[model samples]
Target: MDLSDKQQRPVPQGPRIDRTFFRQNKKINKINKLKNKIILVRVLTEILLGALRIVHKRNTRAP
Candidate 1:
């Protein structure tokens, strides 16, 4: 039952793969990172704009 012992059993084989899979995975990871960065920048810009609007309103309303 203890598969931890390498002598007890050989490692199970997994799906066969080629270099293309690795290259595609790397490209996908890079794209994901780019998407996340874009999203973060967009969210930050929106927050800053909202804050600026609030500040402008407060300044205009003050006597």
Candidate 2:
């Protein structure tokens, strides 16, 4: 039996996180895992923003 065009076509699935992507992702996950004495949404955002600022500064100063 011959399949129709739609039936023969492979269905696209959701995003698959590859090993390389997961490697960096794991680093972030680990960082987040290191919890402080207090855990708050505002504090988390501040920590992330501070990290971004340091990264931005380092990149801008790079030769």
Candidate 3:
């Protein structure tokens, strides 16, 4: 009886904790994805700007 009660008690609580944990994990994953996307955009913009600067310098020097 004691073992059965212990098992039953944990079973209900286990799923509850897991549900909350999964919800939190999903939120965190979404935030991480957004951050990564922002970082990627910033890096790409920097590279493009640098390339443009180099091209402009060459064009000006040629003339």
Candidate whose lDDT is highest: 1
- Can you write out model 3's per-residue Cα lDDT over 1-63, one digit (the tens) per residue? 123222122323543466766566556666666766899999999999999999999889954
What TM-score fits each model?
0.73, 0.37, 0.69
Q: Quick one: best TM-score, which candidate?
A: 1
Candidate 2 Cα outliers beyond 4 Å, as residue runs: 1-39
Candidate 2: tens digits of C-alpha lDDT, residues 1-63? 322323233333568745665566556555554533245766988999999999999999959
Worst 10 residues of 2 by lDDT: 1-10
RMSD to the true structure for each prediction, in A, is: 11.2, 18.0, 12.8
Residue 28 of model 3, lDDT score: 62
**lDDT values of the candidates?**
0.68, 0.59, 0.65
**Worst lDDT 10-window in candidate 3:** 1-10
- Model 3, global lDDT: 0.65
Q: List pairs with backbone clashes in candidate 2.
A: none
Better by TM-score, candidate 3 or 1: 1
Off by over 4 Å in 1: 1-16
**CA shift of 58, model 3, Å:** 0.5
